[model samples]
Target: MRTTFLVIVLLLMRNDAWSFVVYDDSKIWNQDSITFYFLDGTSQQKNEVKRFSQLWQRYTGIKFNFTNKKPSFFNFKKFYKISFKGKNNESTNGAINGLIQFGNLSDNIIFRKTTILHEFGHMLGLAHEHQRQDRPNYLDNKQLVTACMKNQQQSRAWCNENLFKKFYKKVFIQSEYDPNSIMHYDISNITSKDSETNSNIPESLNNSLSFTDKFYIAMLYNPKLDKKTLKKMHKQDIREQQQFEAKANAE
Candidate 1:
């Protein structure tokens, strides 16, 4: 019975067309046709791929060309991808999704939805907003700072301010930092003396993708890969993936 349920769940992730909401103010000006090549992987992994593609299409007004391809050594590097594991001891169990290169968790239920969108954020080249130098006022925990300092790249504690301008032909409001964003995380194991003041950060750890996740993906949807944009996004993706793998192995 469990196997049958898993099979049914996997089948849903394999499909191309899916529906979700668009909560942004502006309509995505999807200007191109984007293609997704899904490599052999689990249902959660494939569903993540589909969720991202669907979000990208809706937010960017781009037509998505998708396919499920046999696993290949180079396919992930060649296309947008998501991979999952049953046990990710690196972070929270049932932590659901995280950006692939940024971090990994002890995988549990199907948090494929959040994982796909967050990783796609990395693919779009946005650094973690919590690490912004201007965030000191917003974040008061010394432990959070230490953890962020230890993982500077993943935390995005320091990134070039103009990072996005280099790749975008037209800059939109997607540039602003949004704490409530599904991509954003709440205060984790770190706690504050004044829960009243610090409680603005969601009490529970969160990974659900928000409206902004859908918006920029739609904005950057280019059917014909923009070499410059693709390169920039991929560079970040590879670097973050390496970091996650390194961290995972160290444990």
Candidate 2:
């Protein structure tokens, strides 16, 4: 019952000439490195997050650090580091503070690893792969909503907000659908869309990041990805997130 949505923000930079450099990618972080802290949590829970968080840093070179000291409120912060709190298994995107919530981590080792990977994926600016518009039509949306409501003990409204909503741009499309992706769910029930059926069932959850996950995350946050390639991907995601807002206004 995990869900994620993008938050739009501008990351303006400048060169020696003092001109603005636009890095307005809503689906990715404004910078490569970010800091986060736990407002309160058990040592075990904090250890779990610290353990699985390394995967992203290893692959994407995005740094995550937490601190124990508090900063003065008078500093007037522009960009904010996330502060993880709450006991729910939810994560939010962007440079805003108070993003991730590590719900009571279950004893299942694999499940614990997967939860951290999944939530950190959102923390690192990834949306639900299953929510992509170009995704195959094998998902049972109604069943998904119902299952989330029951198994996750979530409300219908909460389920829709987190799980069922589509995040896409009608005019632009790009995807790297990996069922084994940490950003995806493993639904064993019947497929309710195209006759594709079981052929498209996402494989059971695993404790590791899919190959595509590492590849793309590196591209998005690392130096290997060129400007042309980065802009192409960023613009499509922008159309998917930011421009969607603009489009919705005219409708």
Which candidate number would show the highest lDDT if scored against the true structure?
2
User: What are the lDDT figures for the candidates, one per model?
Assistant: 0.41, 0.57
The sequence of per-residue lDDT tens digits that candidate 2 reaches over residues 40-110 is 66677777678767877866666777654464466443233333455567776644554677755666655
lDDT of 1 at 197: 38
| Model 2 residue-pair collision total | 0
Q: Going through the candidates in order, what is the number of backbone clashes in each?
A: 9, 0
For candidate 1, the per-residue lDDT at 148 reads 41
* Candidate 2 pairs with clashing backbones: none
**Candidate 1 at 16: error in angstroms?**
40
* Best-fitting candidate, scored by TM-score: 2
How well is each residue in 1-251 modelled by candidate 1, as lDDT tens digits? 32343344345442332121111212222224434455346665565566544644444454645567643565333343333443321221111222233134325322444455554544444444454433435464544554443433333332222111112222223245556454454544323334343555555334444444444443344323444654565466446545745665576
Provide the global lDDT of candidate 1 against the true structure: 0.41
Worst 10 residues of 1 by lDDT: 89-98
